[model samples]
Target: MSTLRMAAVSAPFGRDLEEDFARIGALIEQARGDGVGLLVLPEACLGGYLTDLDGAAELPPAFRVGGPEIARLAGLAGDMVVCAGFCETAGAKTYNSAVCVTGDGVLGVHRKVHQPLREDASYAAGDRFTAFDTPVGRIGMQICFDKAFPEAARAQALDGAKIVCSLSAWPTSATNRHPDPAQDRWTRRMDLFDRARALDNQLVWVASNQFGAFGAMRFAASAKVVDPGGEIVAWTEQREGLAVAEFDVDAVVDAARGGMDFLRDRRPDTYPATGGTPYVAA
Candidate 1:
């Protein structure tokens, strides 16, 4: 298999559509120069994330999946496979969504299924987890809080995803704040989730997050690429930059699963079914 160069971005984006596109264009040019074949941008990189998680925070502008914005994004992507987040609207409903694209147009899309804090007040929950084919490999996408759930990544892996891109606008702890954003507990949790999910599913993990501050929220920008063995291959720790890594996706994933084969040794039959009554000690 050919070596694939991928990057996860840690940069700030705001409510200004033109400003956001300018930033994105510059990043794409940078990635192109770095020979990146796959690029994952931060969640809500299109417009911006909520100012506060409180239900009162004004929502970002919503766009259609097939709107001009995505078309412009695809044009910027050209031949490169790019995954980015945006506020998507379908009729009266708005979703925190991610889309994968190239010059050929969209490859796949994922609506955020999990909502943290008061996020539900801003966007509707997604229904399912699915992986799709891309130039790099079979890729799956999940937004911010979705990575915390084991089932989310597990479902993608089960559906043949070799790489999972997690886009986040995750912020610092609301309470017990740390002076340095890097030292914050929420930042640690974000990193932990990336590593844990990669190890659990034995696939390549790429994570992108917002940098700097937006509204009352200060984001934790720890973008990274983790190997199937749960090792950090490349990272941009608490800063604005790109975490770039190059490797043969199939080779690494196969080698990781060769030993234990976590996916092959499942015992789903013994697992409790939905709504199954719990056993009580006598």
Candidate 2:
């Protein structure tokens, strides 16, 4: 299929695993009804996010990646592709992870690379960035703060990701919470990052974020689907809903990169060779 319908979600998730899965099922069914071939959900969609970054007492228990929860999610995914975030428990360590699944089984997974502030206290970070082939297309997944750094998305782009799904549980600035969370500086940064990342790599971007309040944090839900030209084709600005868009994946990418290939035009050899402090990868 040249043109594929996609849906990106902006919704609140809590510690109630059953409720979360129910909501996910509803969203997936809704997307399927809307003829969506792919659906992207927010980070921590499986379980609620941390109450606050200032060291919360208790966090949602981590789940094994190959456990029943992921299997149920995969079953619900059916034919349509789904990408959602969960706290992944591997051995004794837990990491913030995003998994892509279909009716058949797991497609790919990404452990968040960049942890902001006190996030490290809750979860381990991922060591690398990779793009993998999904039923929809070659895509990459990145969690919240990961989008802030140009390298994260670029790494996926260089690895042949035509589409990047960014799942975030982002919130308004704790110090200066804007009366309108949508207008907050952090929200602006999120928007800028989405567009910049899409434009920089000249690829399609699907950004899904959390909405509403959880503990002391209130999210700025700005889920959106950006075209290869860095324009929002569909968006839910601070609202809890799905932003839907359709595109002939390959055609869109080709048209945006026809004359100028951003990937090919890179001069990585001359870029600041002086290595400073490298980001800690999980």
Candidate 3:
């Protein structure tokens, strides 16, 4: 498929597995009706995110990567390639993970490597970034705070990912509350990161975030689809909606990199091997 119809969702999910599946089913049916081949859902859409970033909040129930929950998700996905976040279990360890699936079964899985605030207290960190083949394209996955780091996305890009899906459960400022969520600093940062990552990697970027309030957290529902040129083609700004767009993925990526290829002109050799010393005035 040359032209891919894709969507990034901004919707709320919670602790109830049944309720979450209901919401997910409805979203998938809606996307199928719209002929979307790739659907990206918010982080923790399976079991919900931490009630609060503080260490005191209870962790969500964890399911194995090959567990029945993922199988159910795959069955629901049918022909559409869907990506959603969930709490994954591996024996004694639990990871905040994202999985890509279809009726055919799982395509890719990413355990979010970066944890924000006190998140580390609840879940163990993932060690690697990987991109895998899917019906839609070569896709890389990242959770909320992972996108804040350029290296995370770059690693995937370098590994031959053509599209990146960023699933987020990001919330607005916990302390400095903003009357309008659209103007919140955290919301602004999320949007900036989405665009910057797309432009920096010259790949299609689909960002999905949680909407509404869950416990003490108020989410920033700025889900969007950004082109390789760093332009937001579709956005659900501060609302619960699906940001959808159709484009020729290869064509746009080629166009973006044609004039001045960011990846082609690399200076990795000049950069420090490890964290370089802080620059001092000469």
Candidate 4:
């Protein structure tokens, strides 16, 4: 893969799963027609987000791992790689997870390592992260609020991920941004955390967030593709729209090691995770 053309589709939320999914199908087809090789949808696009999301038992069992929900989208990859935000039930716990699907089948599932501050009332926090090799580039995902934690991005970058795509439903509130502190503030501190992650990690980043109002929740975060150099290559309006960008794999290398060499001068010896203590965002 010489270059990566990423597309993010921002659609409805909550009870509009089927409709949004159908819209995504059309978007994928349209993108393919326009020569798009990599496509991504908004966060929790399957079960919907920030409203009254039902428990794991309500979803069809087949959609669990090898289910119809996964199959439906898997069948859409016409020689292109597809990633969508969806719900996952592993063991007795359910998580807000995402899957990467190749044209052949499901390549891998990424359990979001870091969860939102108020996410405890919903999905259980995932303890792992996964990065996979793709035809376009090495890719990894950190759903929504996961971008706020530098360690979450660092963990993936250290594992050989040149690019990271985060499916988010950022809030429109202030103070705690990126759905942190359990507040609805996507529009308030929208770019602060995202830009920090891209600039510090030096990897191509796609932060696709939800839009429109569903029930009492409204997601205003725009879709953006940030370069490894911390510069936003493409960003959509704070309200709604689709964002697309073409990223060369080499750009990430140059940004991370060249003039934007922030990671190289880090003093890791001074900071260590001595205990498994939970992190609290202020």
Candidate lDDT (C-alpha), each:
0.93, 0.90, 0.92, 0.70
40: Cα error in model 1, Å = 0.2
Model 1 segments more than 4 A misplaced: 274-282
lDDT (10s digit) by residue, model 2, range 175-237? 878898878999999999999999998899999999999988899899999998899999999
Model 2: per-residue Cα lDDT at residue 76: 99
Candidate 3, which segments miss by more than 4 Å at Cα? 274-282
Best by lDDT: 1
Higher-TM-score candidate among 1 and 2?
A: 1
Q: What lDDT tens digits, residue by residue, belong to model 3 across residues 1-23?
A: 37999999999999999999999
> Which residue runs does candidate 4 get wrong by more than 4 Å?
52-62, 174-185, 274-282
Candidate number that wins on lDDT, 3 or 4: 3
lDDT of 1 by residue, 30-62 (tens): 999999999999999999999999898898989
How does candidate 2 fare on TM-score? Answer: 0.95
